[model samples]
Target: MKVKRSLIAEIKNMILQSREQAIRAVDNTRVLMYWNIGKRIFEEEQAGKERADYGSFLIRSLSEALQPEFGSGFSVRQLERYRQFFRTFPIASALRTQFSWTHYKLLLSIDNEAKREYYILEAVKSNWTARQLERQINSQLYERLLLSNDKESVLAVARGEKVPSNATEIIKDPTVLEFLGLKQKPAYYERDLEAELISHLNDFLLELGHGFSFVARQRRIHLDGDEFFVDLVCYNRLLQSFVLFEIKTHKLTHQDLGQLQMYVNYYDRFEKQEFENPTIGVLLCADKNDAVVKISLPENNRSIVASKYQLYLPTEDQLLKELKSELDKLDDIN
Candidate 1:
């Protein structure tokens, strides 16, 4: 009787596992079907000699014909998107199984091929949901990468050929805090900002970029009868190091860097494991003194970074100016 019961249980488990596998296979097939459909529609539309006029009429006619028979999926806009879908991704094998048709729609909206490719690779590699992919693309992930890394390195990383080494590699400076629901140009204290960040910690971490895991906030350490408090402590799994943060509402000073360095030294000596890299420190200030920052750190310094933070996302004009300045510097080096 016992032997028979065990056999029944095993059989039921096998059946359940088989059912899940079947479901996944069907889902994958559905994705392939859509890709093929998009490809067919695109080719037909292109063969229309009038091009623009034919393309518009094709979508409108297809929507009218298919909507009644095929139902809600074939709207005029969706038909147009399908035409674009075929145009953008002529190769069906490259369509990611994890993403839905909605994901491809967002990618299609990106005008630049290079930028679209970057977002697609990142979204697939990260296993981001459609909404997350849309948000990151809309948030200008490619633009941020261009600002932070050299063009070659940025392309390499986007193509998944290279992995980022440090926080600065992935994290954007002047982090856009508008998503935190904080007032723009409101009278707020540093402590108030800290409180709001803690309240919206998950959003802050996303804005901080990949690999950051929260450790402690307002962490205190005791040494030789003196106590020091670091504003935020985080661990970057990719970098394999502890990231110490010191937040200042005002302009950064050399002393702020010194204080952060002390925290990093303490973490390196006592807190971090032998296998991990030395701790890194970040000075998150409302303003920064570039001359002081250049003089305060050694030329080869890798473990400390200082970045300014803004209450709001910068305008396109500001972003363009910053980009031009950075490009100028790179040109000078070359």
Candidate 2:
């Protein structure tokens, strides 16, 4: 007799759970084994302190002996990494079971203690795969946040000690769109950019930062006899507000700022619930004049932001230049 669909699903779920648990158990065991090896090697090295430093010699000999007997993974470089891993995380109790040896290895390469800790905390909270962790590090997500936020606030958010209260806390300027594979030099229409963003919505959302969820594209609003469409509508659960995005293929103007302000007001008047905060409007433009933006918005404005978007990742030189420029602007204000 054929099994009932519900019963079949239950069996399959049980099998899947068992497989996942088995994989996790194996990974944890492997991590512990490597840690133990590292500890043993470190202890042995300490015992021979009177002799000239022979750490490299010791690891090379160990690799040759272990590889011939056991397997291919036991190379001198990997052994050195394992040794460094133990040194980095000396206390066994501090090792996270959620992280595999690969995760720790990648993290060990990071020289900054605060940044490493932040990545670990975020990786655990986000349940990121090893690949995701690597990608975030490569993208300099932490450094990008540092652009707009104080170091203390950035570290606090990473540690999950403080929740982000405003849109500025989460939004990134010069948002990277290299994933969309659009040419940098070609002149593109706003609709083309919007379409590409929608097509690669997942990457776009990841680039958009935390707490954003897609709501609508070309969201329509009617007023009297006129109709208007917002480029994109998203909600930020953390901020508890509607976030309206208006894409501009050219430099931002006073008129663009006014249009976004109108959208924010519309959402505040019509869409926002009593418990929800005010709507936020973001103008994602190719370029922006800070003077024009400051003059167009209200003195106490917290609801609208204009940020540039980039078709490619900025080079190290470009990032350094921009950071210096920002610092200079701060000095001028002070």
Candidate 3:
């Protein structure tokens, strides 16, 4: 006799879930074991602080003994990593079960405690994969936020203690678009860039910052018998607002800002619900003049923003230069 299909489906699902849970259990145990090892090693190292190379000697001796029995997972390199992990996060209770050793490996690389904490919060909150977390770290997401916001605000936002009031609080000024796979120094039209962004919508949304969801591409509107098309539309749930994006493959002009302002106004006036906040307009431009952008918008403007888009990830030298410039600007403001 044939069994009921639903019964078989249920059994299959149960088997899959059990397997997943078992895997998780083993991985969690491994993480705890490593933490214990690290804690012990750290205690020993601290006790021998007077010996200049005691820490190195301890790790090398431990690896030589452990690797032959338990495989290369306990190699010298990995032992050092485990020790560093314990040093980075001393509280065992604070370790998240959802994170694998790979996640800790990435987090261990971050030197700043606050920045590491921010990444940890975001990773757990977003349920980011190891690769996604690595990409965000490589993109300098934390440093970018520090450029615009105070450390307290950024941490508060990450920890759910405060709501973001400024668009710059969530939106990165110079958004990285290296995942779009567009060639650098190559001329591309707005439509071409739009197509690529849509093709890599996940990456685009990731770079777009938090709480954004895709709404439409080429959103159409009619105003007093005139037709207008917005390049892209998104909704930010955190802000409870519609986000209209206008793409420009050239340097931003006052006229471009004016066009984006009109789109934002239309959305606010017609599309946005009474409970929702005003629409936000952003220009994804290849280049922008900060002075022109400031003067083009009203002094109290919060709805319209201009953000430059980079085709490639900023090199270390480039990031240093950009960060230095932001610091100089802050000094001038003070």
Clashes of each: 0, 0, 0
**Could you give candidate 2's per-residue lDDT for residues 1-334 as a string of tens digits?**
8879999999999999999999989999899888888888888878876777677778889999999878877888878877887889999988898898778888998998888988898888777779778767777776777777777898898777898877778888767788889887757899999999999998888778767899999999999999999999999987899999999999999999999998899999999999999999999999999899999988988888889888887776777677788888889999
Q: RMSD per prediction, one decimal?
A: 4.5, 2.1, 1.8
lDDT of 1 by residue, 187-264 (tens): 468778888888988777777766789999989999999998889999988788898878888889999888898999
Off by over 4 Å in 1: 1-34, 50-52, 67-73, 158-160
lDDT of each: 0.79, 0.86, 0.89
What's model 2's lDDT at 273? 100
Better of 2 and 3 by TM-score: 3
Q: How far out, in Å, is residue 74 in model 2? A: 1.8
After superposing candidate 2 on the true structure, give the runs of residues whose Cα lies further than 4 Å from its correct spot. 50-52
What is the lDDT for 228 in model 2?
A: 93
Global CA lDDT of candidate 3, please?
A: 0.89
TM agreement with the true structure for every prediction: 0.83, 0.91, 0.94
Rank order by lDDT, top first?
A: 3, 2, 1
